[model samples]
Target: MPPTDGTPSDTDVRASTGKKRIPKACNPCRHSKVKCDEQRPSCTRCQTLKKTCIYVEKPKTAEEQKIEDLEQEVLVLRQQLQTQRDTESSIVVSQPQRLMGQRPPEITSPDSNASLNHSSPTWTSDKPLKRKRSHFRMQKEVAVPDFINEGILSEPQALHYFNSFFEGCDRYVPIFDGSDGFAAVRLRSSLLLNAICAVGCGISGDASVDSRILHVRLKRWLTTVILSTHAQSLETVQALLVMACWMPERSLILAIATRMAVELQLDDAFDRLVNLSISRPDTPETHILMKSARTWFLLLNLEQILQVDAGNLVDLRIKGVRRCRTLLNRPFSSRLDARLFSQVELNRLRAKVNETLTSHSDDLLQAVQEARVDIDVWYQDWKRIMEASPLSESELPSLIANLTVQRHWAEAMAACRAVRATGVHQVEMMSPEAHDMLVIAKEALQNHLYVMLSQPHYLANFRYAMDFVWAKCAFSFLLLLKLTILLPDVARQDLLGQGRALLNELTKSSGYGSSKVYLRLLQLTIKKYASRDQTHSGELDAFIPEEFIFEWDFPGLNLFSSPTGWDMLFDQYMIGDDLFVGMDI
Candidate 1:
């Protein structure tokens, strides 16, 4: 069927666009703004985009309207033809109908095509297939070596090793034994071994060794010595305590050991001498030894208490006064004066004891009452000593410096003042060793004041101590500096002055080695201050020797890691929000 006119038919034009135009009843391509060639079913644009080719009803142009009507008629004819073909195919396939009961053929209308498009893909496979077998290689077993022999040592060998390693050492001599003591030793040794073993346990890196066992051993040792009551065991306990006190990084251990010593009433032995007649006229040597022993005990007591409860400043001061009174009661031979009557010595002792009431406990009301009773007594004693064969003014500075080393700050200050009152600056100057003693005393007083100031109850006493020490150290340093610079023959007369000059010269000439030893005392004092206040950051820059700070390999410092030392210092120093903001360091 060619067209009557010479023009090509609409079907031929539709094939070029790969689309078909439809009637007004169903023309989705026209509404979708795609080119619709006049065909019955599918459109080119939907096919190209792989979208569902849907036919929806729409109005069409006159020419398109004619083509659409023809398409509907053609569709009806195709449906009839498909029905006839299906009937014929069924008849041919079922020629011997008796083999099975004849069944009617299922009818599918032209509209069924739309229903088929909506259905999902079938799940059944067309053919059945067998799976292939996979082969796996077997792994060989590994044999592990037995470690039982290495794991545990025999008891006798262990004991021999332990004794050989620990018995001769002053710090770890064994003093206890029971059924369990051997086991305790083994346990402690095992802990040490474990710590060593842990270092090698990790495959790729060193592991942290647990120090808890070591801490526990120290704690138990402290407890045993402190709580032991046997008189026979006191010597061993005392030895252990002394050793424990000397252990590095063991402040807590020392504190506990000291407490144990106090619990065992060892301090009472020293206190007992105050009541004894060791100062009898016939036994001057015994008196001296007793005095020395008492002094030693007092200092030890003070040191132990200071180590434990440094924050309890008022209690320490009170305890110090009580100890002083106890010492005063026992008159040393040195104080008797060979020419003085025994009664005079007794009277002087009474007066000295009375004078102690003035400095009683740093309490305001108590101090006032005690001062009125004691000031005259002290004044008389001072007058007697001053008038009768007084020490040379030149000797006072050296005496004071020695007293400072003995932890007698008040006596040292008095000696310094006495030397100063004589208008003899050159003799009053401190040598380098004397300077070191002065620094120690100054640091102790400052530490005492710092602790006192921290407590609200001791504020007034704190101020007094602070003012006294600050003025004393400042005046002494200034005097030393002035004398070192101004006095002729200073280097020959004063070792400390010469040391200072040497240090100055070294700094100027870049001689670091000689300066470092001299600067160590100052550096230690600075370290104490830093630890006290937790402020060691830039404060050490000026005090620590440049060579020591830069050249020495500080223990526990990791050079590869980012700087954590400074950060830790900042955390330790800053107390509260007051110093939190704008902290550049």
Candidate 2:
């Protein structure tokens, strides 16, 4: 059996061991009893003979099977744990609908017929089993009635509204920054999509459903679903801010949105980003950081303006409000950024003026001079940006610049009103304050006339939902009406005629409810004056109600402020006062 050279021969060794050859051979090679070389796909013999080669695997051992089953079970447990974690993160809890005196929205599950626990011991039992459900449901349950399904806005009509929003509404709001386009927005948040459509419907005036009704429906859905769940989402904040700017219940909705943003830590991010020294790279995280930061800045700007418009003084001592200057000083910021900063500065100056006037300070003239100087300084600081080329996406620069100038004119009127308020009631026709007020009022009215004649769309369409726009126009008309009656000798007849013509046009063309009320007052006031002049020729003692003429608390009288002093006026004019209270449809 041993070889001659002290090694065994292959044939002698195999014969002595009595073993088969090539145990690892492929099926074809093994069947032929040939060496296989154990190649992955084929053996040398099979390749040479042109035959199909296949390998037969041995059965797995018991321990290996058990290990695989355990791994699959771990994977399933991990998925269930992740689901539980996600459910815990949301704000919704059990039976929240019952707390609101409403039933929970019903949703049908696709896996209704499948057993949730097939491994349970009672899987085949006929006895009833207790159903298990999540402690909270974060998914959207209240569905927005499809405007398209309701035949309010068709697909093409919705496209038109979307286009209108991107073209115009986005310029003012700028909330949808770095959006991936309409389809992506639609896929992400239907609440935001519907809010855009409703605001656009107000601007475009093309919807079959009344724009107010659309807004009401959207508000209902937002409160029922988004607010009820306390959804901590950036899209929810954006939708609320947009509605606050364009719809009723502005103050309350704005407060809620600001609170939500604070809760979401946007203010912290805003301060941090404003203080950062190095530039951030182009990443998704950077995009989100920039978006949240910019939204916070936008919210602050809106708050300042809203407070000033409501005749409330804003405390600029807040750190976040002060950061506006730091961001303004940042180089290479966008034109919109420049505009936003300038608005904040301008509104800040306006609040200062309101505070100075409301306090009845002794040095009123000096305070007015200081406020005017501050406003002019702000204008000079942003003058270059204001005159720069229009944005690539919009022509908002020119529009905003014009609006700033109009606001400046309104500010001047406010200053004049303050000066006149200090003078005597009798012999008021001869007072220098009266003359000064008339001069500024005439200029403001002429500017509005110019805008109406040249850029009708600005007033008629893009700004239809902005209450301040109508408020300013109404205030100017009221000033002209009251001043002409007081100073007939100094009244400019041509300006009065032009103001009446504009009011008539607005009454006919505008769809806002406030516009109709102010224009009707104009007609009624003219009739009152005419009838009084005919009956009492030179007796001007009881000509017009002293309160009506002198009271700054009346609606449409204060150009830049809402009426917060009179309950009757608020009740009669502020129709949407309760819109956001209980979120009633």
Best by lDDT: 2
User: How high is each candidate's TM-score?
Assistant: 0.25, 0.59
Tens digits of per-residue lDDT, candidate 1, 1-585, equal 544332334543463344554333213353454566534465565556554454433445699999989999878866775665556434522111111111223333444332110011212222334656569743342221111124433445444333432322211111222211434433333332221222112111212322233334434444443443321123333333333322333345445544544443334433444444444422443343343333234335434333222221212121333233333323342231211121122223333332342234233233333332343354344344424424224323322232222232232232232222233333234344333333333344433333332333222211112111222332233223222222323242343433344333322322111223323333332233334333322211111223223322111011111222443322322232232233221
Supply the TM-score for candidate 2.
0.59
**Collision pairs in model 2:** none
- Clashes within 3 Å, all models in order: 8, 0
Identify the runs in model 2 with alpha carbons over 4 angstroms from their true place: 1-153, 178-180, 225-230, 275-277, 312-335, 389-397, 400-404, 420-457, 460-464, 487-491, 504-585
After superposition of all CA atoms, the RMSD between model 2 and the true structure is: 21.1
lDDT of 1 at 11: 49
